[model samples]
Every structure is written in structure tokens, then in C-alpha cells.
Target: MFCQLNKTKKRWRSMFTVVLTCPKEQEKCKLPPEVCWHIGASISNGSWLSQFLSVFLTDLKIDQIVTFLPLPPRALPLQELVDELYNFRDCYFETHGVEEAGRKQSDVAKEIEKTLKKLEEKEDHFKHKAEFLLQKGRCLNVAPDFSAVAEECLSRAVKLEPGLVDGWNTLGEQYWKKGDLIGAKNCFTGALQQSKNKVSLRNLSMVLRQLPAADSAAHAKQVMESVDMARQAVQLDVTDGTSWYILGNANVSLFFSCGQNPQLSQQALSAYAQSEKVDRAASCYPELHFNRSTLFQYEEMFSSALGGYSRAAELDPGWEEPLEREKQLLEYLRKVTELLQNKGKVKARRLRTMLSNLSTSALGPCSSPEFRSPTGRVGSLEPRTLSSLTQGHNAGVAALGKVVFSLASEGRMAFTFGMVDSEETCIVVMVYNTADSWGVLIGDSVVIPEPQVKRNSITHKDESFDFRSIRVDSPLLLIVNGKKQNVQSQLAASVSYKPLSE
Candidate 1:
């Protein structure tokens, strides 16, 4: 005989109810009231169920019956479930390169939710619930549209386990993402109180740079401290590219705030170079490229600047700052090139008069008779034309020119102007750390001593410009209209804040 079974176990007392009629009495007969059988089991020849049914059927002198049903799922061990969840989380964190990590974060989040739910039901007995909570918080921290919940979870985790360093760091990062700098700073500080990890140190360094200070001195101190913290983090792990990148940023901050020192710029560049060498994955970071580009742009290394900006833009398409900077730089170059190209047509007569009127006697202390040329000639200390300036620093030489066009200041830290010598050779002059009130007009004479020349040939997108430029790190080195300039004031450093990642 064949029979069907009901799938619902809770609603039905037995697998199924069967009714049969006796052959002689013509009356209905019922089988056993209770029959227990698991789903997904087949009754076949030689099977246990088949054997049991065969014996029972033989007692009643009945034929054989066969059936198949679904099986119930077995309960998974709690430890095994936690282990699986941790493995998945580890895979997500260890996967380098966001693009290649094809795992869906939403699915991971769902799994985390499921585990959390299980842990919560056994909260009174679970010993490692706080750790899993931290994992869930971290997973939510990176997942999209989960910041609020991530913060809540992270807060709960830290509350449950005050000594959890990772929880504090992650909570700090969450606050950073929300633009709560003070909260972020506090969380990082809390993490440091528990441990001296590089992540917290580097993150604290970044946050310190953005924090406001009481005065210029305090600001300078804060920036220096930030640099020091970053250095410490780098020392902790020399191979950490993220730490190196933060060090570079801190140095850049020092460069701008502490008088636009070229040495500081060089230090920042060195840090960036070290970062790239030790960590190839650093190339995947957009902010590193962008900040490096900023330094290059400041130094008038146009080609390298353009390349960095381009790479940064490619790395993060959602970020518009790189694109804007690239456009502004190209436009600036185009304008500068046009101005230089038209110098002859627009101010030829005035430029000639100014050049003729230029005198070495007006250079005062700058016009030294003991000054020796690059060739070590004593008598050749006289002013040379812009065309005579070779690539790199023209040591022991002075150049006199008439300013023909003044480009607008960039970041209010550098003053750029175009100038032409007696030979009508035009070049760009960039003076750093100059006050906003200081102005170099169109017809003023500019005398530069030991001018540092940089040749730039940049071709970016649909724009191209070629020019030679001079970088003057200090205004005290410049003589305008035969009078030596003094450093009365300097533009304050303009620091930028952005979300950073490791």
C-alpha cells in the first residue's frame, strides 16, 4: 500500500492519517493513531524503515509500500557559527583593493545580523558577545547606509568592553566620517589610553591637524605635534604606507603653516616617496595622489602635478576636487602662457623702458661686488638677463627684470608674476610666504638673487603650456624697485580636511 504524508509537523499530530475498509465487514479501519517518521527519508528494499514496514505488513498479511519525504535540518553548533562569521569578516578585511574584493557587503551584514540575533538570545551566557558586537560595528562602519547603526553598535561595544582598543579606534573613525572631529579625537585618545597602536596614532595625527588652536603659536604647536605623532607611528611600523602618507600630510601642513619652508616640502616629498616604495598598495589611495599633486603644484612641477591629479581622479571618480584642481591648474597655465606670449604686443614699449631703467646700484646690499658667478668669476656679479639663467639654481648670480603680468595668488601663500629682462626673455616668478598686502605691480623692477629656475612643459587633456619659472621661498631674498623687501607678515597656512583611509 502507498500513503501520502503531511509536511507540517506542528499542526499535524502524526505524519499522516490513513483510513482503510475491511474486505469482509465493509467497515472502516484505522491504523495506529501515532506514527513518527522524519522527512527526506525513502522507504525502499533493505532500508530500516522498509524492514520495519515489511514486518508490520506481514503481521497483517499486506503487500509492501514505498514513500519519500523531506528531512529536517540539524542544529549548528554555536561555536561553529561564530567561527564561520569570523572567517567571513576576516576575508572582507584582508582583501586588498576594493575593486577586486567582489564580496557583497550587504550579504556579510545580513550574516552578521543573524549571528548577533543568536548571540542576543543567549546574551546572559555568551562570553564573547562584545567581540562579535565589535565585528558587527566594524562591518557596518564600512557598509553603505549603516553609519547610524554602526555608531550605535560601536558605542554599545565600547561600553560593554572598555578595554577594546579596536572598538575605540573604529568608533573614532566612525565619528570622523560623520565630521565630528572632537568626538573622533576623544575616541582616538581613548584608544591610545588603552594601547599605542599605529592606527590610532596615525588617525590622531590626522585629526590634530584639523583641530582649531587658540592662536598662531598654538596652531604651529599643534601642527608640529601632529607631525611628531605621525613620525612616531611611522617609526612603529616603517613599512606602513598609510602611516607614511599621514606623515607626509603632516609635513605638508608644517610647510604651509611654518613659513612655507622648502626643507619641509622636501621632507614631505621624501615621506611620500618612502610610502610608495614600501607599500605598492599606497598607489590605490586617492588622497595620497591628490596631496602629492598639491605639493607638486606648489613647487611648479606641472607635469608631475597633472599626472598625480589625473591618477587621483581615476582612483576615485566620485571625488570632484581633483578634477576641479586639474581644471584650475590648466586654466592658470593657459592664462600664464597667453600672457607671456602677448607680453611683446601688450607691454612692449613699457617693458623696454623698464628694462633700460633697471640699475644694479638700486639692488643695495643685494648688489655685492664680492659676489662670484657660477664659473667662479669675481667681476661677473652683475645682473644677468632672464635668458641667461640656466636650468636649476643659478648660484652667485643676480637677474633683473620688469614685472609685466601678475597672476593671482594660489592659496594666498605664493605670489606669482611674469617678468621680462633686457633680452625680452619672459619667465614666471613665484614668491612664497608673502603677505596678502604685498603686491608686485606690472611695471615694477624685480631683482632675484640666486634664482631657482624650473622648466615646465605640461600637456594635460586639451590644454598645453611650456614655461620657465623661478621659485623664491622667501620674500627677503627679493629686491623690488632697487629696495630690499622685508618679511613684514606672511599669509597664514590654509589646511584642508578630508576623510582618510588606510
Candidate 2:
């Protein structure tokens, strides 16, 4: 009985909705009132009354009978009434018990293999079954995973019917889903060439919109023209949200071609804003919200940007942007709190409260304050010495000493040198100052370019003792050979050379 009802249900769905009636009446069923009511009561589980008539034909309740009789075609035969009631009951059974039954039958692979075998036989009766397998493959490809079998199945369908838009759309959508933008573009382009339907146009437009600018401006221009054609196809059928979206994108391309001119950018923004106005919520398109979020970011509207990211995630929960943006904002908030706390303007108690609030709000509730002791720590300013200079040495000198400056990491060194006393002494001086050079490491090397000279300031005096070191007014990089060295100690230490060139 259940199987018969299932077959009937499928048949009913395949044809237009129908009513059972007697051929002699040409309109109403030939069944008697009592019999009809009996039929209704059997199907009474539905809104009909066949079973009541079956049990109580002698009862003269004409008004009641009429009330139960649905207008003519709605009136049912006893047998047909029983069948529908059973079918409705089967629906309830499936709803409540199917999941448990399905859980027990864990050999999904076997079932799928059976279906695939049936599909390979090219049986027309199982076309829908074949299509279902193809659809399952398409779902797996939502991440754009290409399986040789899945592509084969979809292509087979396309071969069977060149005009089946679903096959092309599915193949193209698979490429689009997998982030193969070029593959998606090619497939969609092919789909468009094969069919000019609204669905195909919409898919092609979406792929085109995401494409980066082509290297050849001519190709880019051609692509831009295609965007317009896609937009027009959609506008012809505006009920779908995607058509308007394509139009918005075409306008954006036009705006982009206008370059950085403020007017053109505003126009692009306006176009995108129009796209945003369309009810994208009706369709699960995360790109809609993602694009809006980008525009908000450009405008420096943080809250709006976050809101866009959040909405995109809500539409497609797997999206990572909203979660990432929230994390970045929290990190930024922590930095801001640290900057405020370091100012030290508040009373100690107030400062502690503020810090606590910052920790709670920025780092979340589980955070604890970590304080460092000033006694044992030195930060980037202690002084140390390098080797001392010799009066008659040919090479440059190095000096080491203890910290002198407030921010000194090492000791300071100062030396005064001038020409040795002689009646006809000619003073020739050259000093190479080293600063800002970073040290090298294995597998990594640093390069320091010679500094450019901006100006030369030379001074001369009669007395040798009164003469000072020639100060080169320029930035100098201190390097240990080819690589730079870090001066962790901030002290005033300099090396001066008196030329032995003479």
C-alpha cells in the first residue's frame, strides 16, 4: 500500500495537479454523497471526509455532508482517498524515522557505486539518477575540487544534451568556487557562447567581475565590454539579484578606467553602493558584503567595515574575514591601551583601574597584568667600550667605555687629536664615522652603500692645539666589513684618523 501510494505521489507531481471525477458528469464525481463522504473520512487524515461516509451513510446530515465535500474535484473516491491518506502518513514516517534508518545504513560508497554503474549503462529511465550523481560531485567541487569522474559525468550530460544549461553552469561554477579565476572565466565564457540564458549570463558576469586587469589594455577593454553585455542580459530579467550586481560591476570598471580622479572614484563608489542596495541577502553571495567591507575600509570607517565583514560571515559562516578583522581590532585596542597607560598622568589607583579595564576589554576577561622590575633590567642604553686608538697607528681606532648619556647603552669616549708641532706642518685629516649598520648572519649578508656628500665645511687655525677634528656633516653607516653592526649601547664614541698618507 505504501509503495503504491509513493508511485501515485510521484505520478501526481509529474502531471499537473488533478481532481478525480466521474466521466458521465463531465464535472463532478459520479460517486454518491454517502460514498463520497465515506471516501473523505478514509482520507480524513487530510482535510477530506471519505471515511465518515464509509461508516455512516444512514445518518441524514446533508449540510454536514456538503461541508465536508470540497468543491467537486476536491471530492474524492474511497480508494483514491485511502491512498492519499497513506501517502501523507508516509511523509510523517519519513520525517520522524528516516534519519535513524539512514544512520544504520553506513555503506554510502556501495550505494554510490551502484548508482554510478546504473549511470554508465546509458539508461534513459535513470537520467535523473545520473544527474543526481553529477550534482553530488558538483557539491564536493564547491571548494572547486576537480575529480576526473565528476567532470566526466557533467561533460557526458553536456554531450547528451548540448543545450543543458545546468551542466555548463555547474562546470563553470565549480571552477569559480575553487578560485581558479582563469579557468572559471574560460568555462563561463564558453557557457555564455553556448547559451544566452539569464542564469549563464549571471554566472559569466560574476566570474568576469572578479578577474584582475589583463596585461594588454586591449584585452582589458574587451573584457570590460563583455561586462556590459552581461549586465544587459541580467537587466532584461531583474527579478534575480545577480543581474543588477553585474551592472554595478560594469560601472565600476568604467570608473576604474577613469584613474585616480576623485570624480571617477565617487562614481565607482556610487555604482558599488547601488549594488549594495540590491537585496543580496536573498542570495548567499559573500562577495557582495566583502566588496562593501573593502569600500568601508577605504573610507576609514572602522565600525562599518567590521559590520560588513560580520555580515559576509553570517551569509557564509566559513568565511574568515570577519573573524580575522575582529582579532586585528582587538590587537590594535591593546596597543592603544598600552600607549595610554605609559603616559603616567593618572593616580596609581586610577591607573590600575584603567589598566584592569583595558585588560578586560582588549585582551578579554582572562588577561592578567605583567609588570617588569626596573632593578635588573637595562633597555638599549647601557655603555660598553671598543679598543682604544694609538697615536701612530695606521688603521682607524675603536674605543670602549662606561655609559654616560641618559639613554646610553655603553660608556662614552672623547678624544682630541691635531697635527704634531712643527714649523711647516701641513694638517691632513680624514675620519670615518660608523653608525646605523646592522650585523650579518650565516646565509644572510648586508650591503652598505657609500654615503652621499651633501656639504663640505672646512675650518683652519694657526695653532695646532687649537684645531678641531673636521666634522663631516652627513649620515654615516657603521659596518663591520660588508655587514652592519648594532650598537646596543647608546653612548658617544667616535673614531678619528689623522692621515698617515703624508
Candidate 3:
């Protein structure tokens, strides 16, 4: 116990006692790392004892890492160690090139045979055996895994070197791809326990996301927890694009499970866009676009969804998910177009953005130049809002009140809510006419780049939390306040949209 007994200070209200263990009888209660290092090196006592010394020093170094302690001499740097591990993983992955599942099963088998034969000539090394199994597992003709053999080899490799972080992570992934969620979960947990790292944490969070849910609410809770882990991983290492993608994926899951949370949906979309910006593989990443496209499809943004799905299909022709979604969305697109073309019953349909001075629809006071209109932010629906969405305006209004992104309940439209401080790091959804980035999408479609709403030449009022909505009905005439500007999205006969006005 550490005490201030000799001091004139008050009797110790609290004391912290630290105890450390030693392998052998030590005369001193505490030993410096240098002394430990020298003693360890001397006792191991052979030219080949460098290995044991390295092991000891490495453990000591790792233990001190969170404390931000400097490394003792003759110990490996953590980053250098991580680099070496990654180099080994990359070398193995690159050596085989991309494995084509159905076509190259025999070739992969042959490659395994060659590797096994070469290994027979040497003293069977753990890394060599592990590498053989890794190649075999990765090359297996089944989807994304080698079945039992790959798992067996990978499991053995980690057994051979329990400290090998990469092997544990890879094995965990293999298990996950094979649908052994519990097995995958355990492996990732083991990896994190052994080595707390961004890759392992990110993987663990994804595995958590995939775990089977007991019920709807249970799944939502799980997704929220998983999202927290994913966000933590991203914060730990922003450079890792995979972490960002995982974060987006978790948010998307939460968006669905938690009664279709619009805020979560927005987070999912933003995270995805950020992932695309940073991830080089996004160009040909089928899963990335497919997931993103799926979001668009749910939003009834058909044109955007179609583009995403098409690009995903082009990237991986074998993937079925994109093809299926594309087919469904195409039908939706046709229906939307036909509905727009034959709208005899409806009064009118358009995203009615009326200025105060407009004759037909005047949302704000013409006298006051400081009022900003409420803007709609798009959100994807799962089972909710789609029925009314597919139907016409009244159905839309009825469904709009129940929409996942419905700001009407909050007394305004979507995109109307933002931080009071505009410059702060926060979500911003502005008017289509004034926002630099905005687009229009009919049901299940966004036509390439929707025509830009001509920028408002007038300045806007200062931001406020005070929100109010007014009822205005007008045919979109593209004329306001005796001035005209070009709007990219037009109200044609076929376009399907209900004005967000009561």
C-alpha cells in the first residue's frame, strides 16, 4: 500500500496498492524494464535466445502501449509489427489473384497440391501450412469460402501462433461468410481480446450486426449497439474505408429495424457517400452500390436506384441481388411513368415551391423577405409508406403523415430541421431552389441528374428553431416575383409527386 504516513498531511483517506508478479524469486519489489530485459536475455543464455527475449520484450511493450509509454530498446514497434502482418496477408492474397468460384475450383485444388508438395521438402513450418490452407480456403469453389478445409487450416494457423492477429481475423471472416454466425462471433471476439485493433473491432461490430435477432425490437437494440462499435472503430482509424462502410451498413440496419428511423437513414446515406469518397474499390464494388441502390429503391428514387443497380451488375455480373432489385425497380419505374402520363383524376402533381409573391401559391408573406420555406428530405421506406406512395396524392398525404421521414408531425416538412448554427458540423437539408446539391426522383426513380432548381437570386433569412407551415395550392408556373430562373426538375404530365402542402 502506498501511504503518506511520515507526512504532516491528513491521514490517508484512500490508498492505492499495486502488486506485480515475477517468474522467479526477486529481492526487489519493483524492477525497471531495462533490468528485466537484461536479466531475461542473460537467463535465456544462448545465441538463439533472441527469440525468447523478443517475445518477452514484445509482451512488455504491448502491455505498456495504452499507457503511452516509450518502447524499451530492442523491442519491435507496434506499427512495424502490424505492417509485417498485413504484408503477409497481402502477399498470400495477391499470390493467387482473384479466385473465380465455379470456373477455377480445379485450378485452386491444383495450386493447393503444388503448395503441399513444396512444403513436404522443408521442415513443416506453421506459416507454410497456414498459408497452404489459406490459399485452399480462399480458392474453394463454393461462394467466398473453402467450406470446412479453409476453416480448419485457418484455425490451425492461429493455434500455431495464438498471437497472430491477421489469422484470427481472416478465420473469423471465413466463418462469417459460411453462415456460422456464432463461430464467427467467437473468433472475432478472441481476436479483439488478444489484440485490440481497428480491423478486429470493425469486424466484431459487423459480426454483431449479423447475429440473429430474437424479435424486431431486439434486433433494433442489437443494431444500435453494433453501430456504436462501428462508429468507435471509425473514430479509431478514419483511413480504413472498410470501417466507414461497416458503419454505414449498421446505420442502415438500424434505420430499418427501429421503425424506419429517418435520422438513421440519413446517417446511413451520409456514411455511404463518405465510404464511396474514400474507398477506391467503390468503383467496382458491387455490394457497395447494391446496398446504396437498395436505399434509393426504398426512397422511391427509381432513377438513382437504377443507375446504382446497373453499375453494380456491371461490376459483378454473377451477383443476383442487384439483378433482382433492378428488375423490381424497373417495373416500378414503368408504373410511375404510366401513372404520370395518365393522371386524369388528380387536380395537379408537382413539388410545389411557391414564393410569397406568386399568384397561384403563396406560402410565405410577400411583404416579408425573410421567411424560408420548409424543404422535403428523401427517406427510404421498407413496408411502411410504400402502399400510399404507390397510390396517388391523397394516399400520399395519408401515408406522408406516417412516413419514416415525416417532419409534418414536427409541424414542417423533411429537410426543414437543422442545427440552429448553420456553420457547425451538422446535417443540412436546404430548399431545392437554393441548395447547391438537390435532385428530384419520381417513384423508384431519379432521372440521371435531376435538373437543378435555379438558384434563388434573393438572400435568405437568418436561421431559427421557429418553424411554421402554410397551405398553398398552385400549378408550377416557374415564375415568381416578376423573375424567372431555370429549374432542372420539371412538372410534366407523367411525373409522380404530391405537393407537401395541406
TM-score of 2: 0.40
Model 3, residue 142: displacement in angstroms? 11
Predicted candidate 2 versus true structure: per-residue lDDT over 1-502, tens digit per residue: 0001111344334321122334344346444555544454556555333433333333433232233344335433323433343333223323333333333223333444444444345436545553544444443333224566666666676676666666777766666555676776666667767867776676666555456664546545744675666666656775545555555544444443433234544544554555445543322344555554544443334455556666655544545655565445334333323332332133445434433322111211112223111222222211111111222321222111111111101211111011111111112122222233312221121111121111112111221111112221111222222223344412222211111100
**What is the lDDT for 423 in model 2?**
19
Candidate 2 local distance difference test against the native: 0.39
Q: How many residue pairs clash in all the candidates, one count each?
A: 5, 41, 11
lDDT tens digits by residue: candidate 3, 174-211:
77767787887788788888977877777777777667
Candidate 1 accuracy as lDDT: 0.73
lDDT for model 3, please: 0.45
Which stretch of 10 consecutive residues in model 2 shows the poorest summed lDDT? 400-409
Q: Pick the candidate with the highest lDDT.
A: 1
Q: Best candidate, TM-score-wise?
A: 1
Q: Report the candidate with higher lDDT, 1 versus 2.
A: 1
User: Once superposed on the true structure, which residue ranges of model 3 sit more than 4 Å away at CA?
Assistant: 1-143, 343-502
Which pairs clash in the backbone of model 1? 39-70, 39-71, 40-69, 40-70, 40-71
lDDT of 1 by residue, 264-302 (tens): 999999999998888776766778889988888877778
Query: How far in Å is the alpha carbon of 391 misplaced in model 1?
Result: 2.2
Q: RMSD per prediction, one decimal?
A: 12.3, 24.3, 19.0
